[model samples]
Target: MRELPYDRLKAYEGQPVATAGAGKDLVNEPMIRHWCEAMGDANPAYRGPDAIAPPTMLQAWTMGGLSGHTDRSGAYDELFGLLDGAGYTSVVATDCEQEYPRPLRPGDRITFDAVIESVSERKTTKLGTGHFITTRMEVRADGEPAGTHRFRILKYAPAARMTKAPERTAAAGETEAAEETEAAERSKAPGQPEARRPRPVINRDNAGFWAGVETHRLLIQVCGGCGTPRFPWLPGCRGCGSPEWHTVEATGAGTVYSYVVMHHPPFPAFDPPYAVALIELAEGVRMVSNVIGVPYDKVRIGMPVQLEFLRVDGEWELPVFRAGGGVAG
Candidate 1:
């Protein structure tokens, strides 16, 4: 039997990645304020004199910024070196999972310990063949367990791009007719695989929002206790500690409160250089969605937009904003 090239990577499991690590900054108001501003999250819970950090900011406090942690062990680097030597030179962060046991407050100090949790067997993906490396970091605030962060990354060689078919020269009329026929036939062909955008994670908490999308309506969740509105559909209200909420259909009018242009690590389902906007609805709640009806460069803060549904593929529809005062659908 032939041995697998990645079989040796299994030995790296359960190794120490970092220990006795300390965060560069303590939990403070300035960082929390910056994060809130960037995310367009005006939740009052994150501001003021008694403010606590957002639960999702658990990993931010522990990050060493551009100058990485000095306490990181060499085992992690050695593992990467081995993979690089084997031709898997490219790296991409796949995803991260975080669990917060306690709310981090201002003046709380942060410390952490991390270990290489598990290494997956070599797997082939659209990006190429590579092994998944998972690291689990245990975070503490003021010497008490506060949270855990699990981060995963893929190191793989880039896949060769598909070659385009050569163009044929002929009379314009015949070429047009032939091309139209070919496209029609291709669309009707059986067992043809099509690239699709990744489906949004639809769980109980946000299922109603997706349901609204299917009907071409945008619904915002309103807290029954405080009359405050929220987007991205959470199960409970962040204010007043209320789990009771109701849905309200938005007026479909909004402004581009903020936006970012994506232009790297292309995905098959999305073109690069597209604008993703943070839209502040007329209801005064902000939601993130793609901006259409204008070039990526033309999207700007305070630009007025109208709501519409984007049919990305056969089975999925997404709520998007169309800029330049187009009628709302």
Candidate 2:
């Protein structure tokens, strides 16, 4: 491995990266609707005559789109070039956090200024050895303070590929004995404990949804004011801005609205090449969950599926959709 220029990277920290970068479009209904649909956010406050953009969509309004931003400072580009020159050429977004002071409304022009928040020392991770670079942007709505978005990305050289060992053939008697042991394990008592998988981050807004999952029921939130049903429950209705809402049990019947086959960066808790789907339930709401009971390549949009409570581990149960009547082991 080549030595990374840690001092040069750390020196760029706290520098201004972009100034007065503007969003391509003013806050408008069309873009808001598209965002809400894609996110499956059905807050009444995001619709109707008086609607506010989803607070989590703070960074969306500041996106430069395909043509890129003209106001981006050379420092930002230089920082990336330095990393690339150091052989940390690949980049992947790790996560982002945002805080919104006020909701964005239609006709509000969006502008932002960003700074290189911090550059971490070179660290080793599952993806590879890399530096984590963070940027913080202050977003304004028509010159008024609206929100702040902090984004982080990992810049790293690709991990060395693992070489597979040659397979060894076993004798007939040894193979039979191995098969017998496997069968015995499978036929063991169902009460045996299993390894626990990662748990979901449950917060005040989505605790109820997880509680419902524990009981093997799929619940969708319904606004009391406009009677709009929504998935991935929100505190208020996006269509009517109603704070009061109740839950309705989903029929567990849905169709795949969109999907992606995950094949890279395998995790310990999950196998790669699995299908993750955005399912549109019969209740007119959509939610993201794994689509099991079929091969990853077979999961297509509009495929009919039924809800199944999947026991991911001994302690956690998640709601995953099973394609057709086939069940996942």
Candidate 3:
């Protein structure tokens, strides 16, 4: 019997993918401050004297970045070459898991090593058929065990493009055919049902925001400490590191600060080529939402919009902005 492709991939497991690698820079407060600012993290533990790096930033210290690492072994390249030869060339990160044994602080020198942890059997997914490859890296800070990071990726051939069926036509003499064509047209009408949009993620931090949507109101979070308003509600204020906040109803006015048109790799609920805009509200806070009441191509930066509640399906309600002075929520 011929050996399967999965069997060949299994041979690469438990092999060293990289060894004796060292971080390009030491753990420093400057990089930590930049990361916290970008992530909107205002926790006091990450700032001031006696600060520590965020636990989730473990992998960041050991990355080779754009310069690429010279310590990487040929086994990693050979594994990818095999997959490419088998016509599975596309790749996407699935997820990652990490564990911290000790806190990483400033002035700590970092080093790491990685190995091929596993190769899974062939499986079919919405993206296509592919194998999952997992790698585990052990990280150390100043020669002490600091953390472990496990990353998984999928290498697959992309699925075929989706297409719609041809529209049916009626013939002059065929009465039954004409009736069937009419029914088909009715089924394709705009009033017919559609796949529901993905539901919003509601946690304690953002529950108030969704509750406001249910009540047909737009709410912005205002920090009690600094009086700064913020959107996409955070648990704490970024400006003054304050967790105290209150909600204020918006005036339903905004402008497009930035926008993008999505057109590739269509999903079940979203039609491609639609405009998603970064809207700056009248209250000086920004949020991302879809722009309606205009064609996708007509959406532009600096376009004025009014807030409204959009019911995409039977149960879910979302906040959207309408261009051209459309109806308010």
Q: Kindly state the number of residue pairs that clash in model 3.
A: 0
Using lDDT as the measure, name the better of candidate 1 and candidate 3.
3
Quote the lDDT for 148 in model 3.
96
Report how far residue 109 has shifted in candidate 3, in Å: 0.9
lDDT of 1: 0.79
Off by over 4 Å in 3: 1-4, 164-252, 263-271, 282-285, 309-315, 325-329
Count of backbone collisions in candidate 1: 0
lDDT of 1 by residue, 140-249 (tens): 99999999999999988765433322433323223222332232122222343443566788899998888988998889999999999988788877666689999999
**135-155, model 3: which lDDT tens digit per residue?**
999999999999999999998
Off by over 4 Å in 2: 1-7, 36-57, 85-87, 102-107, 123-128, 157-199, 248-251, 264-270, 313-315, 326-329
For model 2, give the 10-residue run with minimal summed lDDT: 180-189
Using all chains and alpha carbons, the TM-scores for the candidates as numbered come to 0.79, 0.72, 0.72
Candidate 2 local Cα displacement, residue 58, angstroms: 3.4
Identify the leading candidate in terms of lDDT.
3
lDDT tens string, model 2, 63-96?
Answer: 8889878888887789888888878888889889
lDDT of each: 0.79, 0.77, 0.80
